[model samples]
Target: MNDLQQQLAAIVGPAHVLTGEAELASYLTDWRGRYRGRALALVKPGSTDEVAAVVRACAAAGVPMVPQGGNTSLCGAATPDQGGRSVLVNLSRLNRIRQIDAANNAITVEAGCLLAQVQEAAAAAGRLFPLALASEGSCQIGGNLSTNAGGVQVLRYGNTRELTLGLEVVLPDGCLWNGLTALRKDNTGYDLKDLFIGAEGTLGIITAAVLKLFPRPRAVVTAWLAVADGAAAIALLGRAQARFDARLTAFELISRQSLDLVLQHIPGSRQPLAAPAPWQVLLELADGGAWADLQADLEDFIGGEMADGRVQDGVLAQNETQARQLWALRENISEAQKIEGLSIKHDISVPVSRIPEFLDLAGTALAAAFPGVRVVAFGHAGDGNLHYNLSKAQRQDNDAFIAATPQANRIVHDLVARLGGSISAEHGIGQLKREELVRYKDPVGLDLMRCIKSSLDPRGLMNPGKIL
Candidate 1:
């Protein structure tokens, strides 16, 4: 073994270190197949102490460390660098649910637990861990926290950052900070948990977390509404919010193109409306009460909107199965896009009220610039976040179109900036959008980020070449 490998093996037993190409293949790439990297070795540590030791050894050797969870990063944030000089610290073996405090409505869990596992744990205790993402089956809690993930339920429960109360992190220098308190209100200093929640593993390695829980929604009403355009959808959202209040759990926008792709790719997906409209909404209202009345509320609202000529057509899910089927269409969009081909994707967020204007301007500009290009735009409209993706209609010229990604990004990102939207809504600034972050981030914001990075990681060894 080489000097570095020998040291790494000593830190975490040699049996836990994988160096062969075959064994290291899965750890070196991302889930989306967008990034394929080379790693010197893949190390699996069973405990935070071992992780700290590994980090210290890597730091001493000047070798970069890439912390990986379930390897489900949509923005290539969890993958190692292409330079092949880093070691991947796989956290899957550390999966454990440490404690569950029902009274406090908090769960202490290790970072490697799958999101689904966390949700199930919460459900078993008669509470809800409301960060529900499509990738919950495979994505780890640590990765979700690292990205500060926002999902369908963000309209009601907020993002991963809001769901978390405290964290246990291993600093860049291999010292563990035990901040795993389940306190609901602590005015103690700066909220340290916030720093690591969305740091993308650049600041430190999150070992475990104290996650907040909520009362389970006793009733839910799911509906699919056909709208004229973004403007009408925005208007409908206002009306629904005025009526439903906290029961408004989700309000997602779907385009005709996005629906067509899902129906084409996902099995058993059916058209919810009789005719395809230019815009559609997959909305849900949930509450901790006798929710059978919610269906009536939704029907009455949709009827009034239709009478006012705001809604073209609408369909309410009759049962749980129907509701899930409708949701599958929206959730499988990313998978369908993957199966289809390469596309330029942007997860952007503008103000809730400005969504209509932003869409009109961006869609028109993109259509004018790239004629015949398919723009598959859809997302959590209630959160003013859209997954705006562009692809060539034909496969033969897809590569050529993808090569102009920078030019395309300029069009979308410029508008997002003008409308006060984030270029990366939920996804963090991985290597994929590092330059865009540098270009679009405010000068003061960039300087402040640099100062924080320098203060925490002075040696510049933790997940090098990411976020900055």
Candidate 2:
């Protein structure tokens, strides 16, 4: 082994340090299969102290360090670069629950714990960890915090940023900062946790975190509704929010084209409604009470809307099994799209009220630009974020369509900007959206971001070639 590899092996046993090409293939590539990189070594540290030692060793060698968890980054944030000079630090071995204060309604966990593991731990204590994602089965807390994940429950519980109470991070210079406080009212100073929460590992590596928890809801209900278009969907969302308030936990929008893909690709997945509509909404409400009472009220609400022509048709799930079936449809859209063929995805957001106009304008422009471009639009409409995707089915034409990502992004993102929205909502600006971030980010804000990055990591050895 070389000098640096020997040092890394010594810090975290040689068995934990992998340098073989076969052992490193999966870690080098991204979940989307869009980015692949090489690393000097992949080390899995078992504790905070070991991680500090590894970071110090890499820092002394003047080599870049990429901190990874779960390797489930959709935007290439977890993958290292092609330079082959950096060490990939995997925190999977640090998985552990440090503490869970039921009275404080908070849980402290090591960064590498799977999101599902944290959720189960919270449930065992009769509480709820409101961040729910499709990849919860495999995604880790560190990666979730790094990307500032916004999932289906974001409308009710907020994103990972709000759910976080404190963080323990290892600075680029090998110093460990312990801000792992579970207090909800610590107004001591600027919340340092916020800086590393959404920074995508650019400033430092997140080692552990204190996450907020809520009382488990005693009653829950789920429903699927068909609407005329985006305008109708937004109108329904406003009325639902006004009526249910905080009890409304989820509101997902799905297009007909998107559903068709799911129905065709996913086996045993029958259509939810009798007749298909242009658009659909998956709504869920959860709180304390008898579920039958909530379900009855929701059925009445949907009945009244359908009677008034606001809702075309609707069905309320009568049982938990049925509710999960309904949720499966909404959560499986991305997987279904991936199974079909090549496509480009845009996770953008605008004012909830402007969703309809943005959709119409962007759809019209893309249709004009590419005649057969299939636009699959769906997302958490309640939060004004949508996963807008474009694709063409013809195998011969898929390559050309994929190559036109820049043009398609221009048409869609320019419209998002014109409507006073963001180009990236929950997904961070990894290599994929690095240029897009620079194009749309404000001059003053961009400069401030650069200043913060320089102040934290002037050497640019922490996850280089990202964001800035």
Candidate 3:
């Protein structure tokens, strides 16, 4: 371990290598505080070459390496293992915006650059990155690509995999694969970029990427609508899509319980509607047209929905400030839930058409087994992903509720499997869902994944015990 640390320090700098327990504490845990790991040392590489060199040193010493960016992974994908035999490769020093090609509607950036920084860079170039996340200001792009993150705007812009055009990776054996092309369509051979985009850093370490951009929206209308239930929310989504088409940028379903939690826990959060319905949706329409006309069209469409009894009540943001405030209610949900209590969280996705059924069945099953279980469900309805979480009702012991996680997971995941849904939606299978992946993934697909992992990382010294 001493010799390996010296070699890594030589590759980067002595000052960048950290071995102190205090210095490594923050990097050892996941964002949710659910996973705590140990490492031999934390190495901060300054460039792609330095990263490759560090990987080569680790490979030679047979030490596993965990590639980490901002340490903001929800599934513990970037955290090292408890064995303390691995080296944590911190990528924050490699942060850089290499180039911006507005003509090609793309931007190339180093892995350590924060998501908000990328969005601001695109906005400076009069374009939109459109990959919005509550953690954008803190989460790094490498982690985003590694997880293939999906946000509310995925309804229009797609996930991180779709927004990405190219990647520069440091292979497990210290080789650099520079496939950073900004071309829109290249039917050259196999789509190599897709493999690493959502592999959760098990295949290789992502150093940089070429990301797609879109024209800035000239007009945006944000609205909060009250619906009957998840079924009504889906119906409203269909109606909105039929009328607004591609202009429907976001459609988020928030249950009344979710909204109430935000209202109670988040200060200054006011209800968007007068009378509380069983469910609500936060929708947005954006386009390259005049702002006034865009708002008018959205208002007209919403008025018709109200007249048809699809929407009970709604509120259109008067301006951008109001729009941002409305978004705050949706974005602060996770934080609010955190303040409320400990909960079993699931980032699952089902077929868009079966979302209502999934919700109904899962809720019923959970309620029957675990009495007084609070189901705090909300997420991107347009993309069929829901952050379904559970907590005990008031006066119940959270530890007791949490002890039933395995049972809870079986109930929820079995129903998801029956309805053709994913156990891990945008979040990848890190240490958190490794066992679940084994049970849910097809045998053939799992075999192929194992073969690829073995071929690339034959030594198994790259992010060990993750995804695989």
Candidate 4:
């Protein structure tokens, strides 16, 4: 081992430092296999002090460092570069739930804690963490915070940024900043925790965090509604929101093509509606009230919508098992799409009112540009975030279609930009969207972000080539 590797081994112990190619292979690539990189060494730090030591060692050697959590990044934020000069500092060993204050509705946890584990912890305390994602089983809280992840629950609880109360980060220079406070009403200056939340590890390494929790819902109602089109879906969403108010926890929109792929690929998956419509909506209402009343209210609302032209057909989940099965259909969209074939994906957002326009304009523009391109649109419609993806029916033609990602992105993202929408809604700009970020980000905002990055990590050794 070289001197630097030896020093890292000394800090975290020899067994925790991995340099073999086979040992480092899994840590090199992203979850979707879109990005693969080489690292000088993979260091597993067990505590904040150990992480600080590892950072110091890398800084002294003038080598870059990639702070990795669960390695489930969609944008390759945690993956190192192809240069093979950087070190991967994995935080899985630091998984720990330090404290949970039921009265304060907060939980303090280390960065390496799996999201599911945190959720279970909150449930054990008779509370809800509110940030729910399909990859919750494997993704870590630090990564969720770093990406400012938004899932189906974002419609009600907000994104990870809003759920975060405080953070503890390791500076690029090896200094640890402990700001893990559970206070909900702190009139502190600048709110330093917000800087590292969505910075995608560019600003610093998030080691631990204090997360906000919510009261556990005593009852939940899940329903699948078939709608005429995006416009009808939005109209129904508005009606549901006005009626249910805060009880509306999730409102996801799924295209017919998206549902078809799920039914074709995902085993045991059945279509909720007897006949498929052009669009489908999965709506959920959670409240502390009685379950029977909640279900009746949802049924009544759906009945009225069906009486109008808003809803074509609808089915309410009768039990928890049925509700989970209904949720499975929505959550399995991405996996089914992957099983079908390769496609270019976009996670963009606009105002809720303009969702119909975005779908229409972007769909028309893409069809004009690439003939026979299947647009798979589905996501949290209540928040106007859509996982808009494109693929050709013929797998043989996908190569050419994939090569035209830039053109497709231009058509879609230009429309999003024109509509005052974000090119990347929940996903962070890692290596995947760096150029697009530069293209769409405002000049003044970009300058300020760069200034903050420079101020925090002047050497640019902390997760280089990410989010900037």
Give candidate 4 regions above 4 Å deviation.
none
Give TM per candidate. Answer: 0.97, 0.99, 0.98, 0.99
lDDT of 3 by residue, 356-403 (tens): 999899999999999888899999999999999998857457779899
Error of 1 at 455 (Å): 1.7
Error of 4 at 159 (Å): 0.5
Per-residue lDDT of model 4, residues 245-277, tens digit only: 999999999999999999999999998988988
- Output the better candidate (1/2) by lDDT: 2
What's the lDDT for residue 251 in model 1?
97
In candidate 2, which residue ranges exceed 4 Å CA deviation?
none
Residue pairs clashing, model 1: none
Q: How many Å off is the CA of 408 in candidate 3?
A: 0.7
Question: Which pairs clash inside model 3?
Answer: none
Clashes (candidate 3): 0
Give candidate 3's root-mean-square deviation (CA, Å): 1.1
